[model samples]
Target chain A: MLRPPYEIVLKPYGKALVELARERTDIICLSGDLTRQTETDLFRDALPDRFINVGMAEANMIGIAGGLARAGHTVFVNTFGVFCTRRCYDQVAMAIAYPNLDVKIVGFMPGLSSPGGPSHQAIDDVALMRALPNMTVVDLADAVEISQAVRAVVERRGPVYLRLKRGEIPVVSEASRRFSLHEAQVAKKGREACIVASGMMVPAALVAADVLDANGVSTCVINSPVIKPLDAATIVAAARGARAVVTAENHSVIGGLGSAVAEALAEAGVGVPLRRIGVADVFAESGSREYLFDRYNLGVQNIVDAAWITIAPTKPVPAAPAMPLTAGTYAPV
Target chain B: MQKRARLNGKSPGGCGDGRLRAGAPAPVRVGDLARLATRIRLHAVHMVGIQGFGYLGQALSAAEIFAALYGGGLMRPGWDRFCLSPAHYAVVHYAAAAEVGLLHPEALKSYGRDGTELEAISTERTPLLDLTCGSLAQVISGAIGFALASRYAKDDRRVFALLSDGEMEEGQTWEAAMFAAHHALDRLAVVIDANNSQVDGQVNSVTTLEPLADKWRAFGWRALEVDGHDADALVASMQSTASERKPLVVIGRTQILGGLKSVPATADGHFLKLDPALKAAVIAELEARLA
Candidate 1:
């Protein structure tokens, strides 16, 4: 049977926000003149009165969101992920987190999703947000997850840092499924190895699991939307069932999903051999999404190789092969 | 409403219409506001004296401006929103808020102390302080947002914010200014304490904001300049609608360190904790001033 060509489906990050504003009058959308980039234009068009275009002022946008949030308004401050995290970290930490204001920061183009070079990449956003106290960090896997993620953040009090992927994103999960902040969704169940992933990495991890399954490696894929208040119980349970565990994320290995998973495994006294497939500690150059992924060892093959290495039927699987040095650009699997 | 009209009809004030502008308020009590300003300064000095550590100089310089807003009836304490943007000058804001009965006087003891609601910086934990001032030039955005909300809710209550002249160096301040003006947030009023002092040195000496009033006007705001210490004129300007149809920015010209008899005026009073002898002398001076 001939299958239809693969298509990139546009996600509803802005649509969901517009709908939220329709339901809740207090929901306001603020953009730093990146209305089209962050896709908050949908909200802006639906509720022009509630939308605020703060020009190129990212810090002011956050401060304004802080004020709106303090006044009992659900403020959604939008910009690129880099600007949201690195450009104005102090505002996000103190203005939004310290006082625990109800402000949701939506930063689109997480990780290598943007082709605007290293400056636009928000690879360290999750790591930076996770370090802040009283912050809820969530990275969506697809459109279906965003539907749930947006509602969860809006309903819950306190500040939230939501990573968004703009433009046409491939849908991996069912649209009917509900998204829980603290709960980890087991995309697929297996026993040989547990593959934990987040945001856009979930689809990649699922594909890697399939490849691993075809090669006789039964992999369990866990989709963790909440990165900061991580679903430790689920991760620990899944990791315990498998002799080895692997983590995949669309961010730098340091202080992100990989680091969180490592900390969780160590704290829970789960001594499973672990492998992390993500961007190495190096400045990512300008390239297409696929080019950046393969260049930074975040491709499906990297995940497959990492899972196979970790799934070795031995105590503490040797991590030498998994830690492949970046010899040259796009090292073929 | 009838009583206020009758009062304005009798008072020879710039604010004869009961609006907070350069016109004198209907019930002009300049002497009482002046006394309140002195009390706020004394409270600030006393707070700095507690630990022999605080932003005493800027606190003293901004005392009258705070008084004009809180004590003078332009800002109805709890009713009006005062965002203290320059977090270092929290002593000034805390004293003014306490003086107007918005915060309990005892809260002064915990100024700069750990576990106290009163943080060294102007945080939301403090009463009547709506914004948690994190960095410089950012609080104006909060005031703008508050104004937007007030209009959205169809409330006439104005949003007030105090910022330092040194913070003009931050690009976000102008960003907020442009936003407020573009939105025509007439309900939002900002007071720039142009004390000409920062951590580096004189604000203009560091980076000149020459023709600052022109700059504000260029950004679509009704800008004005006034002696920060003149409580009456300052209150009148605040009450009047002279700067209507847009946001207002009052360039409050003030001394970096003013009205301190005991505490030696430093080149920069961004933060100061006087020596023991100086601290004692300052406390004595405040007591005599209060008496």
Candidate 2:
């Protein structure tokens, strides 16, 4: 079993952001009635003028943030991942992304963070945001990492889409641990295989690495907090050194962390057997977080199994590239 | 000039072109405004010719109105920054900006070129523009924000936004209209190019904004309708607008595909193919009008 850091957990990320907001008066928080769920209510209670409740209008909320950003305010717009991605995609691309405004979109309840059903689950946010040219996509592994990522986004003046998981997530870093945006962090080191994971899957990969160590298979666990701008050098070195790679994420296997890793390997001309363990292309049904995790094969056992398969001598054939998408063709209104 | 055209025995079109004489001296010369409008049209035609396709039809239709605003001194020409909502009139906007000395004429020629800062839609990179506009109805809300900020700073700088009739289909436009109205954004003036046509067909066939004036009134805006091509009428209405407690919307009715017969009015004006002869004719007509 792997141990989680206790100093700074996931829930405090929102609280820490509020504390930071006190010093930076320009930071305004807007929520689509998900303040309690995303832990942004902690900030809202403290700064009423700086906090705006846009009701349930995710699309309008994003527009308002973009407007505020244009007026030189560092605005943070928060909502569930599903609504933030699919519901208000046009606002993200046109208002926030295209304009390159200083708006940080915090998508809470990413992947199966909620047991509310398919509607609440956000499995394709990374894929959706990464498609845009100028957008910075981030998936924080734990609460401590979340705070660091939030501060980094504030300092970096551009549009950022942050995918955050809800409720109590295991801590993946210390409060004092500093990391740069768009850089990958090494959680565990080994030579036999490398386990690359993002967001919620980082903790699972750590557990799987411990399990692999007991089984006499050494593994290196890398936490990729930033999804877009993939941190090519770090990922490439990890791929070049390891015999095989296992990628994990709490998102769709199609366009999340796994797909990003594969693209990096192919671009660098480094050939290694890779296994992607994530939710397949299907909507998650209503169930507890544990049920969904087990159902989608996103647990420690699955990661270990995938890692073992990747390192096996008999390598599987490489998958073909998916069909190309033309501009303005993805999702139509 | 006070020709009373009434509906239901009441002056429905309320105070026609006669209101111009009563206004405190007009901001711009009528002939000069007309010349500026012709130049805007000529520039739009050439810009579209360079692209091989563009929203020339709507651009030409909106030229006179844009000219009136830019040339009349009602809006600070080189100093006032604009937030354009309906993005199809890129060529017209750039040309007007150049004529007013806000941007260099050379920069206008560089539009749509590889790595050019002048994009089809208004972007903040232009410096003269405050917000990027392409997706419909977004600029209205953005303008509201800018207007509110100006109010906070106690600045008299106004936010001028130009919207399209077709964009009225977007619900956010109405939301912004209501928001601006409730806040009494008198320093903000929105000009709607109501050419009566949009992509697909006539706006009535797609989404009708009949009683458009009533809609603005319901949203608590002081609405005024004007002949879009008549620069003098537009200048008068703009000058007489209340500047303290209420928002204003100038619904300048225009002829769709104006000055060009081949350009289909019913089609979406974003992309259009112009024949060489028609292009020359447009250029000649604009030059002659300006001369």
lDDT of 1 by residue, B176-269 (tens): 8888888898989998888888887777878889788999999999988999888777887777786369999888888867766565655347
- lDDT at A167, model 2: 72
**Per-residue lDDT over A267-327 for candidate 2, one digit per residue giving the tens place of the 0 to 100 score:** 8998988899888888888887767887888777788778776665465422212223333
Error (Å) of candidate 1 at residue A113 is: 1.7
DockQ, Cα level, model 2 = 0.17
TM-score of each: 0.88, 0.83
Mark the regions of model 2 whose C-alpha exceeds 4 Å error after superposition.
Answer: A1-10, A312-333, B1-31, B46-54, B77-80, B104-127, B151-154, B178-186, B219-222, B236-246, B259-291
Q: Predicted chain A of model 1: TM-score relative to the true chain A?
A: 0.91
Lowest lDDT 10-mer window, candidate 2 chain B?
Answer: B1-10
Candidate 1 error regions (>4 Å): A1-7, A313-333, B1-31, B265-268, B283-291
